[model samples]
Target: MAVSSLSLSLVPRTFKDKLNEPRWSESPRASELPLHHAIACSCDRTTGFDEEISGNCKRRPLLLGVVGSLTASLLPASSLLAQEMPANYRAFVDLSDGYSYYYPSDWREFDFRGHDSAFKDRYLQLQNVRVRFIPTDKKDIHDMGPMDEVVSNLVKNIYATPNQIANIFDTQERTVDGRDYYTFEYELRSPNFASCSFATIAVANGRFYTLTVAANERRWRRVRNKLKVVADSFKVLDI
Candidate 1:
């Protein structure tokens, strides 16, 4: 018999720093620095235990209904989907939340307030993926209403903050396992900095789920495809 090896590497912080501080405050919410951990392992097929980027080899559990208002300028954004998970990406499943998605292998876990699960770039705090969910009576994402109206309202009014300008560039729809999902692209610009993101939403298992992956506007063109992988991978599983 052969055994697989797994390891976790924690980035160090100063003694004066609180263990879980929200670094990105300009946005609506904050980030709890779980001191992002690097993990190397696979989900145990037999046990069904999903991998969390932590010191342990495996752990259980971890949503967004939208993200911070996305309006850099509503350009003609295209719907980009990945047919298959890439070699560089890893699956993140939250059995507790009844949702799962794929993230980049190098990204690590961070405690983002009000989110079910979140991962960020080791070097760039601004680049990340986050999930959030809330109980709902609605059975499908389409229940929220027309895709354009829902996305426009979400980005402009819900996700964007007081200081940011938001806009929607594109919107798309998909059905998986008979469940409908709404996916969209948007950007947010503040006086100081700007960011763009892909957001996917669905309703299932009595919950409304949202997943968003983002990168700084300056690097959006270079990393958008990779982030789209995370966005397209969002799926809801039966409880």
Candidate 2:
């Protein structure tokens, strides 16, 4: 008897596809990232598919909900165990309380908020990306708006023009223990700015987590990538 090879191995097409799954439709809530991953992969899996081809129609992420100690268990079972996130990432733990997970290398953290900051503009520049965090609660559920309106305001105020935003790259709705939230990325750059921006919003820990990064378009491409890692990695503390 001949030994059999494992049935499925996914190989993404295109350089972008290799780095990430094709972008999904813009999400209106931050709690849908997991589902968006499934949906986008589903779309990609069908396109260009030939019945003549033989492979697993594996869509969705390798580690759909793996995090913390659970990740260790997933390593052996998950098909994506071989995949790795960005090197510069350090897990962020809290939104309003300001806690974070440290890199094993002991990368020094930066101060985004200065004296008396109210979340409009507190940032820490990393590599070519600038990141900021904002927190909101049930009393302040105003941060999230309809996708069109939010994008409209962002394009107008940030770029001094309404039409600057084009081609939404990816969107997902995510949650931590059943709260609602979402994240979406718009490809944008303006005259006054040196780079484009990838903005994100989420509701976790009874608070909304928002971050915007402005950096060279090419350099900042990983902004949302890292943000997604952070958002998806979030797990509600045992409360």
Candidate 3:
């Protein structure tokens, strides 16, 4: 549950060595904000079903395929649900999107590009938590490929790496409510600063959901376990 230091040299140097490359942008786009926030912010908006009906509905099964070459584990729903949130954490739920997670109660929410939801430490600009989703035809994560390949592609392409050093520390796949979720732990280092992030991914309702929690590398050791709580707390609710 704690974040550990990693040697940069041991990681594969798959990206071009661009020491002077500009720092990657972590801000979310303007257009992407509305879709994610609309549901969470619209407290009075009604989706028609009553409270009783909503509580009784069962979650749909996730049609996951074989997770190739990767160690896939089944997370017990009881354990996940049973885990207690720390006193300093607060729950953030998006009923319309059918997902929920916990974040540090002290952190303030922010609008970041392409992210459905985002939060930042009151003081540290680099410490953040964000969630985003993309439409997909695949029903399960395995449809994308093996865990290693999927993570490698994600780091190489989607993540910002202008002049950054990337390292993969761990990869885990868990099943909850019949859905397969992948959690990736990694570090990104630059000439000026370094950061570590934990990203949880899952496919549901014809879309891919990703929730990422990050902090400055210097602060990682102090906050690792707390961030893991945020990562593991992510749940795809039954819609």
Number of the top-ranking candidate, with lDDT as the measure: 1
For candidate 2, the TM-score is 0.40
TM-score of each: 0.66, 0.40, 0.65
Candidate 1 vs candidate 2, TM-score winner: 1
Q: Residues 53-137, candidate 2, lDDT per residue (tens digit)?
A: 2223333323345355543432331222112323444332222232222121123332222110111112434322222222333
Residues 1-239, model 1: lDDT tens digits:
00011111112223233222212111111221111212223322121011212233332221121233321110101011123546676666544346768788788777654455688899998899987665566777777778887777777766777788997888999988798999999998999988899999898887667798988999999999999988988888776
- Alpha-carbon lDDT, every model: 0.61, 0.34, 0.59
State the local distance difference test value for candidate 2: 0.34
| Candidate 3 ranges beyond 4 A from true positions | 1-83
- Give the 10-residue window scoring lowest on summed lDDT in candidate 3: 1-10
Q: Name the lDDT value of residue 172 in candidate 2.
A: 61
Please rank every candidate by lDDT, starting with the best: 1, 3, 2
